[model samples]
Target: MKAPSTHPIKPATSIPALLKTAFVNALIALVLFSLMIGIRTEAGSSGQLTYWTRFGDLASIVAAVFGGSIVIELLRQWIGPTGAEKLVPPAVQSGISFIGRYLAPALLIFTLLVPVMFYNQRYILDLAILVLTYVMLGWGLNVVVGLAGLLDLGYVAFYAVGAYSYGLLATNFGWSFWICLPLAGILAAFWGVLLGFPVLRLRGDYLAIVTLAFGEIIRLVIINWQDLTGGPNGVSGIPRPSFFGIPLDNSDDGLAARLGIEYSPTHRIVFLFYLILALALLTNWATIRLRRLPIGRAWEALREDEVACRALGINTTTTKLTAFATGAMFGGFAGAFFATRQGFISPESFTFQESALVLAIVVLGGMGSQLGVALAALAMIGGFELFRSLESYRMLVFGMAMVLIMIWRPRGLIGHRAPTVYLTKAQAISSDLVKEGHG
Candidate 1:
């Protein structure tokens, strides 16, 4: 018998094949960007529609696409289809695992020091607060999408509910932030249950469609119900959160006066920073603790295989309802904070785009991984601000970056799924072992 081959055969790289692939990609790009990029339309001095051409920019983009396609094709040929993982050295894998082990604690420590480190920088403080807001939102959605394996396209509906709940309550009844906070959450949870009842029987794309419609419906209602939601003009002059009933203003009754310290606007900013920080920490802690409980595990099981979950006698209905209610409660909490932080809110603030961004954060961060979601939120929210100077090219760069990340890490930045309960020792489970869930 002939001796077995010592190594696997590699596919031959052909110049013609590479060129062909590049040409096809470049042609597609040319067709797509021709109208979108090559032509710009605007209302001119005469108040009529005007158009201009930017063929140079269009040509440049097509060329870039051509070059990128060829480079990608060459890399694919060099690495071989099944050997992409081999590109990562064993030592690098070990280092990644090590970083993953301690990253959460390190991030928490750094986050706590943010206000002190940049105490005087108002811009940084505001940006940090924005990042933390999304972090809280991500953590809330993580419970539904990441842990419970439910796809929620109408999450912004609950967010709107919470904001409007607080806006209407505080504006009409003159309620304090502390009192409205819990009420906002309770109201959102009620809406969540209302949403959950109809969607309990649906899964996958059908569920997504229904939830999306629900979000649009809520926005429409808000727009048409001018008397209550203030129509498109939005609710304004919402009260800010006080330091336990003491305002942060320069008035004699304010916190600064009470403490015998000089009043400055920075105090309010700092207070708001720590307030959201505390709320985010509560979300993180609650989620971690919940995962060990029976209900949490049931949610996970339902995420993995609803059929198997039912076979094991799990109450899928209650499991799903609790997940929705729990997620919506945190979303409501964040919404309340948002309204108080901005002192205004409108239906425009809670849109499908917001839902998509939060969902992208959860998916890009890796489902079920809190640290991953937090890190993803920072990158996405911060990255957008980082590219603000790019203006026109900002979205192009962002889209490219997202595509590259997905290519390199399709399962997400941190794809490992740690077991809620392990026999010998707790271990990180590979993405391959985790199911993406039916719902």
Candidate 2:
């Protein structure tokens, strides 16, 4: 055949391809970043628009996009297809597991000593409190979405109910935080059951829409029922949590005075930080324990395939309802803690954005992975704090980080799943194995 096929057919790597990708990326940056980040507007004293053009911001973003495109093109040319699957080396997997084994304890120790280490830094304590709140919320949602695969976008409604329950009970009825906490959880669980009954037949996008609508309904009811909810003004002067009978305020018989210690403003913040930490830890513990139980297994089975679960004689309705109730209970607990921390309850605080962020944390951490949830909450919430100086750009960076994480680890950061009860030896299972169905 004249040795025509002696040479291999190599794909051409053209400059035009690279340039085209670069151009497209640059154009996207221009549309998204140029007009938005490049243009800064503030309300002037005259109540008019005061514009400040930030050409440098636009230039930097464009340059970054162009450079990033070149690198991506190079990677494509050299590596070709990434393949549908990745096979991580055994050593690497073992090393990762080793590090993970110690990471949680290390984080716990660090958190425990943070108050002593940064005793005077009230900001650190406040930030810790905020992060832990999200952590608890993530774990709560994990039960419904991660375990049961319910896709609840209105989880924040339960959170709001818990918070408002505590606020109203503490302010209007003079109930203690300890008492309202459980009651709030019970009430939220009841609502969850109500929600579950309505969405029993819904799935996927339909389920999402119904949950979203439910959340908006709660917020609207709280707003229009001004006589009870205080409307948009919100309920303020909500009592703070007490240590036994001792308050952490500046009063004469408060915690500081009772303990005969020098009063410091950071004390309350530190207490709140530790309080949330304990609550988050409790959520983690409960979730982990539940994962080993019969109901938890049912939840996982339902998540993997509702049809198969029902075919196997599993009661799908009870499974879904229990998942919702359990998840809502945890959300309520976190909400009550939030009310105590803020000492205020408002309809604005329970927006769709909060639900989305909590859901994001659970998803980014790896569905049904408690440790993953904690790490994700830390990264996402702490990333926001790190970019506080960037102002509006913080959200931009946050969005980019989430996008990159999803691209790199589509399943999640720690996507490996271990079977609840092993046959021979307990082994870590690749998430890929269960992407289509149950492991």
lDDT of each: 0.90, 0.88
Q: Tens-digit lDDT track for model 2 on 1-439?
A: 1223444535756889888989999989889997689999999999999999999989998999999999988887665445423677778888988998899899899989988998887787788788889999999999998888888999999999999899988889999998999999999999999988988678888888999999899999999999888988888999988886688888899989878888887888888888888888898898888989999999988888888888999999998899999999999999999999998889999999999999999999999888899899999999889989999998898889889999999988889887889788877889886542221
User: How close is every model to the real structure, measured as TM-score?
Assistant: 0.91, 0.87
Q: Per-residue error at 302 for model 1, in Å?
A: 0.3
Estimate the TM-score for candidate 1.
0.91
Q: Write the per-residue lDDT of candidate 1 for residues 401-425, one digit (tens) a residue.
A: 9999998788888888888887888
Candidate 2's error at 59, in angstroms?
11
What C-alpha RMSD separates each model from the true structure?
3.7, 5.3
Considering only N, C-alpha and C atoms within 3 Å, which residue pairs clash in candidate 1? Answer: none
